[model samples]
Target: MMTILDALYLLVGIMFAATAIINLRDSLNSKRWKSAGFWGINAIIFIFGRYLPPLANRILVIVMVLLAGLGGLGRSGKPETSLEQREVRASRFGNRLFIPMLLIPLVTMLGTFAFKSLTWNGALLIPAGSSTLAPLAAGHDAGNGAGGRRKPLVWRRSRLSGLGAGGG
Candidate 1:
């Protein structure tokens, strides 16, 4: 029997593939071959790692871990909007910025609660088998679109990690 977990892995693979395409475009624009290669391999791994033999999966995991530890990934250098320009935008768009942020959660929650229509056979049209994954995946894709590419900063929204502290 296929489970929602299986569906989620497929969705994750798709997301990684999409990200790889974005990374490739960024690389093409900026001549960042390493960035392209990195995300490209990540896409492959996300899509195929489950199908690979255990040893191969372990090796890929090790390599990815090393690359991350060595800081092989770099950010797009497109100048972030200058703070002065940002201040102006913020002043002009005050409270509007919050709309983008709130939209993700709103859509996710709505999807979680209302997306799974009851089928004639009684199973949902969309699986909400993993309650958390449904909303999270919805929000994640939305967040990625609205947030776009920016410098790497610790995700502080969760109380898991922070400056000089373990995530746990």
Candidate 2:
């Protein structure tokens, strides 16, 4: 059976492939052959990196470093968006601009509470209490701390905190 991590790796691989496709489109626009090759290779790594042996993975990493560090994979791309265009976009999408940002926490909140209650064949998809959630919840809690709403709580009983970051 594929574990949750396998699914996540597959999803990430898909995203990497998608990025390569997008970069390929960008390369076509700018006629940057180097950019095309770099992204194309990166896409290969993402899609196959997980399945490769440790030695091959290490070699791939070295190739990536050489391709990017010295090869300038990201250079020579023309600006697709200028400052005035960005300003116009911000004005055009006021308020809606935050929707994408808010969706992250909203998803985390819902996942934390809702997924905990999910079960398959009477066994929890994720156990009732697992540290797997701590990192995710820590980020959310840290965001709250930044707003000063959670600072007092954090200062008071950091020892009693549950999320990985420790707080009230």
Candidate 3:
């Protein structure tokens, strides 16, 4: 049976692969190729490192460290949003924005206990090494949902703050 970590790793691998593709297409970044390579390697590591030999995994990690230490990584010159827009959003959201962050720990604690005895086919639901991470991932999901308009508590607070139905 696959562990929860396997699913999370696949998701992270996809994200890293997307980053690698973005870096590869970033003409403005002088080190675009290096950046792409770095992220591509990270994607491979996350996706397939478990199946690789220990020595190979170590070599890949060393390569990543060397690349980072040698300033091989770079970002595209463009940003999706400007600093001013970010500040404006921050001000617009106010303290209610912090609700998601606060819920993370609480959700993690609850999920840890909730998942502790969960099972499938008599196997432990979470891998031994990922006892903490599995619940933490669930917490992240809960936190994201907690701040949404659908939730009763946040809906009233969001309305009172006049945030309306605007996306954060």
Best by lDDT: 3
Instruction: Give, for candidate 2, the lowest lDDT window spanning 10 residues.
Output: 159-168
- For candidate 2, write residues 66-114 as lDDT tens digits: 7677754653233344557567766876776555456557656766776
lDDT of 3 by residue, 50-149 (tens): 9999999899889988888898986555434545766687898889789888889988888788777778899887876566777787777677686674
Error at 30, model 1, angstroms: 8.5
Clashing pairs in 1: none
Candidate 2 contains a number of clashing pairs equal to 0
lDDT of 1 at 1: 49
Worst 10 residues of 1 by lDDT: 159-168
Candidates by lDDT, descending order: 3, 1, 2
Candidate 1 segments whose C-alpha is farther than 4 A from its true place: 1-8, 25-31, 103-129, 142-168
User: TM-score, each model?
Assistant: 0.57, 0.53, 0.75
RMSD from true fold, candidate 2: 13.8
lDDT score at residue 81, model 3, on the 0-100 scale: 53
Error of 2 at 38 (Å): 3.9
lDDT of 1 by residue, 58-158 (tens): 87777767765776655554334455755675687677656647867887788677655534467655555655566667676676556434421323211
Sort the candidates on TM-score, descending order.
3, 1, 2
**Which residue pairs collide in model 2, if any?**
none
* Cα RMSD for candidates in order: 8.1, 13.8, 7.6
